[model samples]
Target: MKPSLRPSLPLLLAAAVMLSLAMGLRQSLGLFMAPATRDLGIAVAEFTFAIAVQNLGWGLLQPFAGAAASRWGFRPVLLAGVLSYLAGLAVMALAQGGFSLLVGAGLLIGIGLACTGSGMALAVAARPVPAALRSSALGIVSAAGSVGALLAAPIGQVLAEGWGWRAGVWGFLLLGLAMIPAAWIAGRVDRVPIPALAPGESPRMAVALGRAMSHTPFLVMAGAYFVCGLQLVFLTTHLPSYLALCEQDPMLSAKALGMIGGFNVLGSLFFGWAGGRWNKGALLGGIYLVRSLVLGLYFAWAPTEASTMVFAAIMGFLWLGVAPLVSGLVVEMFGLRFQAMIQGLAFMSHQFGSFLGAFGGGVLFDLNGDYVLAWKLGVGMGLVAGAVQVAYALRGAAPPAAERPAAA
Candidate 1:
């Protein structure tokens, strides 16, 4: 069957809004680490452990959420995520100790992210557009997803500074409420028809999983994705604390985070456009390479406000650009029937790295009294991942099995 030429504007807009809010608020959680830890007498490692748990939970449950969306519909999963998000923030706002923080910020928020984050949102965005336009569509949605951070980080910082950490969480709760409507709207993608299976393709999710797992390129991309999650999560979970330890003005972390969000928009769009015209695997590799170099340089210098902002801009541009490329690659390799689930599998690897990034960074800092070692590990792994990805892509990896013409 021919794919639809016209995209669904409402579905795309709704998905973008949902992704923006979900990611924006979650990323801003780092801002709370300093105040929440000091006021509640929780240690930094404990705090980051909660974040690590959040990433792990999100990673572990993501495939299930994606499968549920495949079997039931996107709406139910999305609504559940919004509710979980609100509950998590509420628990966080009212928390008096570590256990509540773990339950609220760690587990509940993890569940919410599994449902509402890039995997589900990008899958929704991919559905309405034709294959020709899919990459750019995913990019536009991914770009909009960055907008939430632009607003959320500054607002959370102001509220936390003025009122308390609780106030910042309460603000996040209010923002999360908007996701309900957005999810409902984006769920309209359920009405769009799935593309017919490619020749020799099986409709069963298990078969799709088997094929993707066996595919060499998919494995390579997913492995490199581990580095992607590690690098980003380290920054989001620790940058605020790192800055505080340096005695820089408290607001600089927020500003730097906001800058990353701003640049993420440009990066997502540029890569989205580029993915359409270039080898997505190579593009993914390039992003990883540049991002690693930027990270190394930034950490090598003693950070000033100017240098910090510049680093954030460059890193931000290189940030979520991976979302479009990764999502596009999954679709090209596997049909949309299980895009969410297969992508979820890759993201699980990313989140495991995220778990290490958040928790491991905290452990390293607690033990060593600084982040020098953590940054070094991240940069080294990222370089290897990028190189492998580039070499594989340049070798002209096979096209999607579904798209390949059959033998006579």
Candidate 2:
């Protein structure tokens, strides 16, 4: 909020380190679903619901988190997030049933992620830097966060195998402690001008929220992002269990996740690079279409070790690349002033999709004893999401004025 506060390399580094720790821990939770559920004497449905709630919390709170950071300070919010996540891990370790799980995993960690994860990282890091170098700075921040993927799954697998899921959780908690200092270092924000409309003019915050809600292009974009959430959460949460059901080698599941993390580095870099040359919306549409095709390939073939690895690589390539495009498109459509709020709404749609995918997958599997139908549903949604993005691309960009809200 201090427009006078300068952005520095230390701030970027702090954001990067915080992101890596927060996301790394969140990504590793899927590996714990089975072990945790069994040990807690809970059904998969209840357990997954807790995680689903976490996603919803993360999405729902994103805008407010950004706003809080803007008004107060990014450091305080980031510090709160670190404490929240640590508390959630501690509670989850001791949780015995649904209530504790929901509160710990669902509420605490979800809000924690809101404060510490990419949304805050981008908003905080981008604010301090000059506009000219902003894009590269954002790119570095994104890459730093993605590195967490490479670390979490494999380490979780190893720790869960060697010690216990609780031990793994504790280890992650210790790791999260590192983020406290990183977030501290990166918490400074350089404030920018706030516009005051003329008499009879609508407030900018009201307009920004309204515009994001009402704009057809943003609506379609949000819908497409929903598919991203659904696909990712389902795979991350259920892939290991799904592999077990298929009687594939147990190690294959972990390896598949590990490969996803590794390959996504390339996917993120390539697609981000490509977005500059290609139409951003078109690239987004293409990524969704590619996901649908990948899902089809996955469903069409019998589950095999090789097939799973291929699926992971292909899917991972498509992973997270949507974010840069989405954020850029937001900038392309509007400017950066209310980017956090607008982008937060878009991300909310994504997390809602995550809620469905994570929670619904569990419910359907519990009822039907398989994920066949769930996978099919995800594919259908993916196709529709692809079409939505394509429609937005073809329609051409609209003026920022077209998206502004009427007076509240």
Candidate 3:
């Protein structure tokens, strides 16, 4: 029997909203770092490490969180995630010392994000959309996250300026609380139940999962995403500070971040559409190449507001575009049997990259007094990732025999 394609509008809307809020808030955390560090009298590295831990935690928890959602359903996981996120925000807000800040920002927020953030949301969203429209749904969800970044940066700056960093954190907590309703609504969408097999089913869930992990194409894609995570998270988390080092105006930093978010919508939509028509892995590989070229040009060219904005826009266009393609590739390779779980597992690699990106940038900058070295490394890795992806695509895929329906 064909699985039903239609899903309730309310469910889609809720997924989009929660996805937006979770992504945007997480992206905006970079804006808080400078001020938070200043107010708490902590080293920039310390805060960077905290944020690194958050990225690591988010990555590490994705597979398990996705599994939990898959097993118990998306609603419970979302609720738990949101509650944990709010508590983390509160912890950061009330923190009077470095240790408190570390616990809240590093550990608590990290785990909270793992549960409530994009990895889990995308999994839920994937369930409702038709197989053909899956890429587009992912684009919409990823774009929502970018929109969050667009809204969060300026708002965070304003709130921090007026009431202070503590108060600003409180604002994030309230917004997180508001997201609970969205999560609840997302849960209301009726799932197309996976019917129990009669006497024999294809393989057990565990066996299928293990097979996917060992799949060559999946591994290659996962590895490429790791590089993407490294570049993107590091840039978003540290770009504002890097701009500050260049002696640019503070508002310029926020505007740059907002510009990245704004342009990312176009990037994501473009790639998502392209993923349907093109060889996804090849398309993704090309994107990484473009990123490398853009970064190299930016570093070589003289720095000016115009140059920075233009570079930001170009980079933004390539930014989250990779997301839909990566997720789509997973569905293509494995079928959506355990999509969220598999995608989450892949995302762990990306998040691990994020951990390196966030913390390594800080460590490198502190040791070298410049971001030059980190930029160079990112360019090189981008090239390597592109090459790796193209190689994976050339290997090709075969249809699963299990996909044929059983005789009555």
List model 2 lDDT by residue over 1-408, tens digit each: 433224367777788889877877787688888888889899999989998999999999988887676567678898999999999999987788889989988899999998988777876666666544555566666666677767777777788889988887877787778988888787665443433343343445777677667777888888889888998889888888888888887667778877777776677666656665677788899899889889877976679887898899898778767766776677555555666667788888999999999999999999999999999999999988898798779777764563232110
lDDT of 2 at 77: 90
| Model 1: per-residue Cα lDDT at residue 234 | 100
Model 1: weakest 10-residue lDDT segment is 399-408
User: What TM-score fits each model?
Assistant: 0.97, 0.90, 0.92
lDDT values of the candidates? 0.93, 0.78, 0.78
- What are the C-alpha RMSDs, in order, of all predicted structures? 2.2, 4.1, 3.0
lDDT, candidate 1, 261-329, per-residue tens: 999999999999899999999999999999999999999988899999999999999999999999998
What candidate 3 gets wrong by more than 4 Å, as runs, is: 1-7, 195-203, 399-408
What digit string (tens of lDDT, one per residue) describes model 3 on residues 1-408? Answer: 553435444676687678777777777778788888888888778888888888898888888887777677878888888887778888989887678887888788888888777677666666667666777777877776678768777787788878887877877777777689988988764365542333333435686577667777788888999999998888878887887888877777677788888998899888888888888988888888889889888876556788889988998899989888887777676555566777888989999999888899989988999889988898899899988888778666542334212111
Better of 1 and 2 by TM-score: 1
Question: Which prediction has the highest lDDT against the true structure?
Answer: 1
